[model samples]
Target: MTQATLSADRSDANANANAGAAAGALRRIGAHLAPWLAPLAILLAWEFAARSGVLSTRVLPEPLAVVKAAWSLIQSGEMWADVKVSTWRAVSGFTIGGGIGLVLGLATGLFKPAEIALDSTVQMVRNIPALAMIPLVILWFGIEEQAKVFLVALGVFFPIYVNTFHGVRSVDANLGRARKARRRRRPARHPHHVSGRASAAVEERAAKRDARPRPQCPRRCARRAR
Candidate 1:
């Protein structure tokens, strides 16, 4: 076969193989979503119940009713304003508290002196329930946006801090072995493989060596050729 034709055939094969692989991946993902079918069925049942008044409309609104309410809010622009406020509060709070937690976690994980200085206070604060802190939070920040942001930040901080601390501390123990195992399983290199230019140079040198006339004893030289 011509080199160009052979290359075209190989390219087509590779494209087909990639398309098959993608199809198989999508099928597997669809299969994994089968577990979600039960939850979907339950949601349908809940809507049916709400529509038939088997469930009190006051206690639990119909799904359609909720959707309509949300749609109305959106049409009125109230939803957008509320979303903006909530988003601002959540993002600001998370950024402030998460940053602090990350820094503290890193410091405590790495340095004994920092741990000794800060860990006790953090643990004590973490143990106190958020509800219990509301009165104090109100006293400090008052009933304002600051109070809401502070409360959200406080709620978000401990989990991030604890998880980060543990992850940092256990990283060598957990991830180090996995890293080594992956390295060990890497495919072996081809012993005969060489770059195109190098292989060409090697072939040229061998051709020259073979073509060169070697000086030999006069008796042996003709016999060797024969």
Candidate 2:
């Protein structure tokens, strides 16, 4: 082929590739945005209804008004102060509750005696709704920050504990059996050495399984807490 013709063909190929890439990127963007379309439409309708006086501002203010109010709060620094307090409460509660839940879950899941002693009591407490305790909580803590923190902690505790317990229990029994068999076969090695290695492997597998449910726990806890 002539050099000019070859160059022209190369340019056409590059253009086609770029077009294809652009189209694919647009498709991906559309896919990501598809879920927001309904919410966006609803917001538009809400705004129209409020402006046209079909909806009462007292019942549900227009989106623009809410945005303006939020902006005003932000400018006044009140929004950030509230956010800081809320964030601290959530973090402190999550840390305290999640930490204890994880430890107790691990203990119960790993040891038969611990499970026997604690699981029934934990389950009983878990059955009681957090909302039902609100009256008692008010009476005890009197609307103080400690009451709020305790409520948040109580809300966060169970999901983490239940998920962790189930995750540990879900670890394959065959894996544990295989490790035991390997330890038995290694009779020449010191008993503690072989057993220690086996236990570590088993615990590692359990730990991985335990992590799988954790991302889900936060969502569940947050919904309940709210």
Best by TM-score: 2
TM-score of 2: 0.69
Task: State the C-alpha lDDT per candidate.
Answer: 0.90, 0.94
List where candidate 2 sits over 4 angstroms from the true fold: 1-26, 180-226
Off by over 4 Å in 1: 1-33, 171-226
What is the C-alpha lDDT profile of model 1 across 48-151, one tens digit per residue?
99989899989999888899999999999999999999999999999988988999999998888998999899999999988999999999999999999999
| Residue pairs with backbone atoms closer than 3 Å in model 2 (clashes) | none
Candidate 1 vs. true structure, TM-score: 0.59
In angstroms, the error of model 2 at 155 is 1.0
For model 1, the local distance difference test gives 0.90
lDDT of 2 by residue, 1-226 (tens): 8999999999999999999999999999999999999999999999999999999999999999999999999999999999999999999999999998999999999999999999999999999988899999999999999999989888889999999999999999999899999998788567878799999999999999988864467888889999
Models 1 onward score TM values of: 0.59, 0.69
